[model samples]
Target: MQCVNYLFLVLILTPILSTFSAKILGLFLYPSRQHALLGTALFAELSAKGHEVTMISTFEQPMVQKKFRHVLVDGTQIRQKYSPSLMSLNVSMWEHIVFSNSEMKYMIAELLEDSSLREFLDAGEKYDVVVSELFAEALLGISHRVNATTVSFNPTGGSYELDYLSGNSHPYSYVPNAFTAYSDEMTFWQRFANTYVNLFCAFSKHFFNLPMQRSLLKYYFPDAPPLEDLMNSVELHLVNSYYLFETPRPYLPNVVQIGGFHLQKPELLTVELLKQLDELKNGIILFTVGSHRKLSDFPVQIVETLFASFSKSSHNVLVQYEGPPPSNLPANVRLMPWLPQRAVLSHPNTKLFITPGGRSSVVEAIYFAVPMVGLHAPGDDDSQLSMMANRGFGVCFRLDEELREEQLSGAIRNVVADPVYKRAIMLESELFKRQEMSPLDKAVYWVEHVAKHKGAKRVKSQPAAAMPLYKYVLLDVVVASAALLVMFAFISLWLCKQTYRVLIRRRQTEPVKHKIV
Candidate 1:
């Protein structure tokens, strides 16, 4: 009877005791909604798994869940200061780097001074893990204060900076820079350009971006660890990238690719929307420039060009615009303030997606098997658009004041009329959907793995992470090999010369032996 009772008690408590949860803090300080979506989805999943999650962002609360707490930071001034317009597309890469660094410095300073964030920091809350976007360096101070393992998250494909943080090797020869339009295969000039951009970005980040962040962090959180220490202490990187979208690249043990994890199943379309799309028998072209830019902000000439091009399209056009409908709006075109992008793409009528090549939009298009006619603005997802075009499922056009209606219309017509684009994307969609484990499950597992292992120290690449750039790239070894080769060549040449000299001396000293021969 005693044994029976003990077994019953053990059985009753086992299930309850095995259920584990961690206190997770997520910091996504960027003001863009597309960037916020990635972090919000990850935290929402963690919260669903019974973890107590506190999310801080500049955007509004995403979801209302029992275990999920949201802290909103007012970023109105920051957005106004750094708002990108269509004209920004014309800015040179060097100008962009300088401008973006300035924006990051301003944003960090503003975040450190926010009253609500300060209150949250002073609350003495403890957390098991801290998940932050790639740019949120100052906010890592919260992780230091709470003594949590840090996980850096990138909303797009991993960059050189992220690779450095996770100790992942990104060879500049083949692996194109995130901002460049080149694919894995490159010409001599293309490779040179890619390498130059990668080095420039690395230099700027190390010298300008990081030092300014450190100064602000020090002023705000004097007791916090050094910025370099905090950055290096990060245990894992969760990047929104995959093999299909971002060509095959090497990832370290601590780096996790969780692309498309935020994608939810397409919901049923609204009755009115379904009706609107259903009436279009030919096909539908869904057009949107993404959340970061507004059609209203576009220059009059560019907007007129877009309208004129859409007017010539045979397919019904669905434009996602915020301003009043144009007086000359074509009969084939309809404008909406927002779009149910996934749902619309899932519809059978949505034949071609016209987008500005935003990362999230590109992923969604691939997920839904919709062919794209990308009007890519500079500094946008030009690389992704290039990839899509290389795969033969999309057409890319430069979106600028110089864009002509005939050029836009012809590409749109060709993509919509051709079946090759559809076939190519359908194959890609099949591969993208064939993952063994869902991205969300994979992301959650890694986050928990880090928490359970107390910072996941075992998986970290200690040597690579601590290595200086010279040693990391093996510059010293190359120099040594070149020096040795030169020494060997010199020695061989000297020996040949000496042998000739000796033979001549022997012949001269041999008297009349040569005459006999």
Candidate 2:
């Protein structure tokens, strides 16, 4: 009877003990608001599942759970230091790279000195898992210090750099760089350029960024393991990418594509906005440059061109402009400081979306089945928007194009007038909707699984991380084959020459040529 009672007691306590929450630390230092939102989705979900989450970021969270703590970092100086020029659209790739490195260094130094962060570090807080944005690899030090499994998160899609770290395959021939305006099927020159750019970026990261990352990690956590080892030691990489928008490519088992994880059911539009939208007899067009860019920063001429196009179009143009409203706005145009983009897109009257082709914006547009006219900027925007155009769901024009006004207006007219764009988008939307689980659900599960299992050792591709470059690319085999072929050719030539010499010597020595003559 005593043994039966003990067993009953053990069974009753097991579930209660297992229900205890795990502690998670999230360090999301990306300065962009949209990127912050992505990080927010992650932490908020973890907290909802009864995990204790401590997040340090530039953005604040309204999450009121007692288990959720937000350590808002002051990114004002960092933001100002790398602030993109509003008046210019001609920033070079090298300049962007330099600025990005500078930003990472500054953030790392600041975070190290931050009193709150230092307090946690000094106190030796224990966490089951540490989450950080994949950029600024030095931030992985947080996980190292806490002795927690690291999980890298990327609000943007995958890239060769990230692929290399995660041991994912990204052949430049078929897998275009996220920054280039090329499709998977490339011309010879395009492939060459892609390969060159990938190599350049790889070298730049290795020579320029890796040293700084190592220095920072050493400065903060002198006893920690090597930074490069810690970077790959990252158990999982959660990327914001989908095979629908991106070319279908094999990813490392540890790399999870949780694209559209930020998506939620569209909120009901305000009555006033609904009524206003209903008044658009020809339908509405939503224009947003995404969260990071200020629509007001557009050059006067560019704004004039957009306005000019809007003036001629029958569609009601609703612009999400951060700055003061433009003067002499056309009656058909309306400007708001902010618009509920997802809600606006879900509206039946939202006939089009004009954006700078940021991944988040493009995903929302496709999710809502709205045709788009892309005013793409440099960087990944160009490639993503270009891919959309290639896939027949939208049209893309570079923001710096001399004839942008004409192109923008033409694209708008064409997309709206034709049924093909709509049909294509509807098909993609249906396909996107066919997923068995939401992206957030998948992300949450993987994150929790990594923590529960102590790491994702089983899912990680072993050969990818362990294989050296020469072996992985088969360079050794190619070089050996080439050397063999050269040796054989040389031997054959030498043998032929020797045979000729022998024939000549025999004829001269024996005097046999007289008979032949």
Candidate 3:
């Protein structure tokens, strides 16, 4: 009987295992360049692991033509009648964080409402698993409709609610007043903030999904966790930050961390670029605001201040300027419209890196062991690194007017001279290394797991919350009833006590009255 039971179990599990080992399709949906790169990288890596993968993106980059199937989701093509300018995209992005909040929800709704985007998805492609950023939450209904498992991939150190989905404790709670920005670590306050943001996020989702405003919230989530974890609509979550970069916390079994997912084949520099870098023997000081922002776009005063600071520096300066060098370019400075960053960072003569804290740039610096004089590129670029600076990972420069040339010079000197910063970074590098699994392998493993077992079905696609704030919190009944009970109990207790006091006083009053008479 036992043998028969075991045989039946094996029979059931075999078909599931077989399904997970076959071909799969992945949905990589961010329209932004940085996020597009991440999605493309995952698609390539997953395809290499022996699955048929199709990619969808917003732009025309080299990755689209690669070995895997590609779907070019030209939002411009979608908005054929209404091409949103790049600047408009930025403005909308800004409003998203402050106003819309759950960018994923807003984007998903936008995509859904657009007939072009839906037509793109309806092209009759079957997917086994869906890997997307948390911001991609607005489209869970589609994923559900198609029967796919979803995975949330994060490259940045995430807030606590995100950490909860990743199966570990946030690191901040482990150490107090230590690292800044994001620790993948949660402080007590950080956890509180996560809760607050989640509550706000659910409402934000409501706003984004106003088309479904009335009945959606009521029917959606019957067993949802707090609002903070609202859009964690994935079967599994993979965070790009490692235990080394972030603090560990308790997460569900499905959450995972595969740091250094952005890593890839090294860039080979042009001979001209290499020669230029080598000639800067007094050592090189490089400045870049990252690909998203052009250096010449810096405020005139800030550009003047940087030029003034370079005049006093002992090292030769290399700044990636879009236009000609600033008129004030000192004799020691060399302006190149474009510099291969990997080559510059790897150069023997390069001593200090001066730039915004792009994750790629940060990793490149770490890889090359080059110290940085970071002037955080304003907005989301700096938003992630503001905490990295606080954690003592790098020297953060305020781009404010008060930051003069002398301060820049001093900060450069401090970053270059300080050995501890290097030590801390080296230690971080080692931790990053230890957490390093070939992300390609992990991604493949999961893809295959889904295909073999038809494992994707286990994941549900709707919001976890079954009811709205008014119903879930039970505020209407709980608050009113509790308030009334408290008032009634207080009044009854006060009346009884007063009556007892009066009787006792009356019993003792006869002696006092006789004396007084």
Candidate 4:
């Protein structure tokens, strides 16, 4: 009822508010397909708000091209979307790059030095504001050049935010996980490691020309904060999460977490789809290795094991196999090149989701509150999947390990039989609902607010970004020490002069004749 009332008020006032005409030139630098959709949705939403918008993407997605005509650059130069192979790196190398705080700064600086892209950016005209994807730091200089309000749009769930906001500590600060308010969770060594990372970033910044940092400040309007809180530079933070999936963080007037607002509802299944779903008597378990892994890449032995196990069972399985759907399908098993994930997840009959713990997949499952079974694979494996299992939402098993088919099957049976996991998810779903306003309304209001205000400076305040770690802690003790030492030397010299004067006076009185003559 309250929601209805709010909607009614918004509808009534919307026309009055429509007088403000704004234009947003969307700039995204990444080659990922997902970023393309985000760019599209943002362009579309802004357009719906009566804002003139144009989208530029490195690659085109079907969803984005439906509405916004995009200019495509060479994608071969861009990293492949969802490439897991590049995810591998030693801790030392990762640490060095991250700690120096220079990695993002340097990369963005080098990237923006492009003459042709600069031409596009230079062509960007009298827009009310520029909302660049976080990766589009490449456009910071351009944004500054255009005198546009620069806002950063981060799609990942607030994992990238610590670089810009203040008061949050290190390590646990950068790693995005379920939120726990401060306690002894981070150890001494971890804090030191994180500190070095920020320092390195600041140190590295000196080597780059000042244009990147200057452009960052010109548009982002953070509290003139330190390098650690770089992401805070955006006037508005469009966090890609809803209240249900996250714990309550006291959001500022500037930050909004709007997830699933643009997500289309699960489409109704075709009769064949319904018929196929109904066939899962024991239960249906949906599995995909996520986007990058070719299903053919899995060991044939493991594939054979899965088939053999499901073939014997009465339970039905819909496995997203990339290669031609396997022949000789059993009565209880089906192979699909793909299935509408949300539709299957929404099915009342669907029992459990067995997947590699990709962030998107996890969020989707959480939105439905389904328990997961993570078949964690090697390499770019289930580092995140393991975290989810540890969170008590799911169980994980190595796909290439000694865990036999029966062992995997038994775990599935347990998750299905136990009512607790499902109940916990339902509770989380309810929290999601309570934690946020309608994602659409929240997002629309913020975008307009940026335009109406004409810049983020009106709302962007979290001043912690302005100071380095040492300065924030007031560790300028060396300055104080130097002052004290100077004062002490002056006092000693004065005393020595006085003592010499007294001794000379006494000597003159006692033995003036002999010595002076």
> Model 3, which residues run further than 4 Å from truth?
1-29, 63-66, 75-96, 99-119, 141-147, 160-233, 247-249, 323-325, 331-349, 377-387, 390-393, 455-517
TM-score of 3: 0.69
**Candidate 1 clashes between residue pairs 3 or more apart in a chain or in different chains:** none
Task: Give lDDT per model, in order.
Answer: 0.84, 0.81, 0.59, 0.60
Q: Candidate 3 residues 85-202, lDDT tens each?
A: 3212134323434433433334444555555456755665566776656543434544554556666676564453353343333333342111134344566787665455555544
lDDT of 2 by residue, 43-99 (tens): 888898899999888776776577889988777665655556421466766566665
* Winning candidate number (TM-score): 1
TM-score of 2: 0.88
For model 4, the local distance difference test gives 0.60
lDDT of 4 by residue, 1-517 (tens): 9999999999999988767767677777655555666566667766765667766666654442333445555444434322323332222334433432544454454345445455665574666777777653435554555566666676655442324442333344434222221122445665555456445444544445234555555544333444333344457767766544443345555666777654533446879998878766667778776654556556667777767666754457788876765565567667787677777887877788888666567677777778888876543324446555655677888667465978777777777778877776676666655643677677778777777786566555556545565665567777778888999999999999999999999888895456665
- In terms of lDDT, the poorest run of 10 residues in model 2 is 79-88
* TM-score versus the correct structure, for each prediction: 0.90, 0.88, 0.69, 0.69
Count clashing residue pairs in model 3.
35
- After superposition, the stretches of candidate 2 with alpha carbons farther than 4 Å from their true spots are 1-15, 85-88, 102-104, 265-282, 466-468, 477-517
RMSD of each: 3.6, 3.7, 7.9, 8.5
